[model samples]
Target: MNDMTPRSFDGREYPYTPQDFAAVSAMVHAHSGICLPQTKTMLVYSRLAKLVRERGLRDFASYIDLIRRDPAERQRAIEAMTTNHTKFFREDHHFRQFERDVRPGLIERLDAGGKVRMWCAAASTGEEPYSLAMSLLGPDPVEGRVIAGADVAILGTDLSGAVLDVARRGHYPAALSQDVPLDLRQTWTRVSGGTMAVAPMLRDLVRYRRLNLLNAWPMRGRFDVIFCRNVMIYFDEPTRERLVQRLVDQLAPGGHLYIGHSERIGGEAARRLRAIGQTVYRKDAA
Candidate 1:
């Protein structure tokens, strides 16, 4: 077994050198704010190996050369490296807080002819945003009537077009629906065979788009709630700080920000956002 070669599950070894790993790391970091430490070497190899094979590339080094010159290939490379590990109510406390605290005001705002918005910054496969929609809309049909026709929008964005496509479809394996509250499941999801689809009423409130967090945001208005959980762990400190500030800027006064349980806000944004709950921050109302 060559130490430099990464062996796949099928016992195929891909030639992945430190130099190749570094090159790929630099490229990924430059395009996306994600930091790729040496620890992720095997992960990088495993994910990109298929791409390398599909393009008939000899090795990661050659694949690196191709990505440098080809914008499209570079994008494919970034997509391959992106981690989209998400599930319905993966962090339940955040949703509970949103449901018990932030959502009521949003409902009131909508009832008074105001528009309400929520953004899922790293929506992976639709679960997080769909979860948000379900929570915001609620399970009790009578209490949910106000929001059922309200002008509320949920924007789910991610860097990967592939995952965004899955999110737009609003379908998931039925087993994953277990995390959804039983009442919510009955009201908002349709189970068929081994798969489930978010109901059209919930789906209609969501819009999926490809958004790079490092790039300029085209959104004009502030959001009442933003779920950017579990995404900043891959970014370096400086990148994470800048991103926190940007997230705060997008927040409407008195709005809420939800992040990964393991993550924290730093720099100026930290001062502006008060820690209201576990991994939850709230901007003071103006």
Candidate 2:
């Protein structure tokens, strides 16, 4: 096997060297569809260093190799890398758009006997998808709809077995709850021990799963709206273009694709998808 020994960093052991980082990045991308940029060396070192020590692995290379071979070890590595930073309704305007523009239009379509499906592609820790569920399933809301939240992490893929254990419990600090609207707060969420959990009604409306966007999507039907936000920024231009095309292919006629505010789909992807707003794309009806 390769030298899987851990290196010392700032008096702590870390996996050093481009080779070590590359190996781990390949493994993560293959399993999760998240592309770790080359500049993210510090991020890799910082995130995985503690795990190395905690697991008593000698070096970064060995640890990665072990993970590659052992399914359980691979799961641990996925857990370490997939811990995303997020909050309820972190991007308020997007949710507002969902309510003010998307929801109304969708309701009109539904009244005409149309059904809707929405996918939250990188539903980190379940905040964005849960927020969407509340918007769609709240009192006096759209009657027929399907919402699917998928992430590459074990928590999401394993049906919230561990990561979602915390998510399903629906507890967050009071500060996190403050950003949620008061009406929404009263109707959509429950508070206990300074942590807020999404109401069961909303939670039940959204289904969470494990899916890697880089790989083939298992769902057969097209989607009317896809929130693949804030995830493509980590991928290379080629990767981004390919991922965008896949998303567009999964979109229904006149469907809208929402990307991260900072990300733009270029190359052939730009031709296939027309820009709708600052960070939104619309597929042609033809």
Candidate 3:
């Protein structure tokens, strides 16, 4: 890993070395708690090289230097390196589990004049929270809080402002809406300019905010259902474990917690949470 290393990627010249990637890995992990493995050198370069060039820097080393000198520039690098891969009902089974067990149980509680809250902790582009909205309340006004006789709200938060902006817009490419069920689509979205716009009712049910899970959480209430999927894969064991425990702290008694299909709760979090389905756990009523 010399300073002069040069590699061509995606038809562009990148003067990044192994050292540069390692520095990036350390920086992002510290900033966002996302561990970028060494294997993603090419992917990292491909995603960040443009930002380097945009900053009038010649290479990764230059960008790293800027981050070292100017803390503000580090946020740009964090934004560039963070991955936000998500889609509506990306894991259909989780939603199905929601409909089968979580929904019925939660609605029963709602019927008993209880307030139920849901958090899509990694709500990328609004799909997941909107899906929850469609589930808890329906696609229109008729089935909302006015008629449901319960307090229901969805808080959708993400670390990326870029994606949060998109989430607030309630619009998406038509292809991204393919997984949406036909009935739900007709009820919740209207097609325009080859994109689907979420119904106002559905939008009304969700609040989008920019939040870093590694930082302080401003949310003050307990949630009955929490969806924080496909995010912990990037965090190391310690960070993941701590995050799981924090999530557990945000849940009401017997509240459900869902993680990515590949993630598992360990240590005390595991002892406190009861596994209910594939990648789904519920806080024990202890």
Is 2 or 3 the stronger prediction by lDDT? Answer: 3
Q: What's the CA RMSD for each of the models?
A: 3.3, 5.5, 3.7
By lDDT rank, best first, the candidates go 1, 3, 2
Flag clash pairs in model 1. Answer: none
What's the best-to-worst order under TM-score? 1, 3, 2
- Which scores higher on lDDT, 1 or 2? 1
Candidate 3: lDDT over CA atoms? Answer: 0.83
What is the per-residue lDDT of model 1 for residues 1-286, given as tens digits with 9 covering 90 to 100? 3465455455656567889999999999999998999999888988998998788666777889999999999999999999889989988998888889888788888889999989999998899999999999899866665686878899999999999999988889999889899999998898999999988888888999999999999999999899999999999999999999999999999899999989988899988888999999999877
lDDT of 2 at 134: 64
Residues 114-179, model 3: lDDT tens digits: 788899999978888988777666545465545244677889999888898999999999777787
| Ten residues in sequence with the least summed lDDT for candidate 1 | 1-10
What are the lDDT figures for the candidates, one per model?
Answer: 0.90, 0.70, 0.83
lDDT (Cα, tens digit) per residue for candidate 2, span 55-172: 7877787778788789877767766776466667767777777787677777666556666788888777777777766665544323322221211111122212355556556666
Off by over 4 Å in 2: 1-10, 37-39, 138-162
Q: Is candidate 2 or candidate 3 better by TM-score?
A: 3
Question: lDDT winner among the candidates?
Answer: 1
Q: Estimate each model's TM-score.
A: 0.94, 0.81, 0.90
Ten consecutive residues with minimal summed lDDT in candidate 2?
147-156
Steric clashes per prediction: 0, 8, 0
Reference-based lDDT, residue 31, model 3 = 88
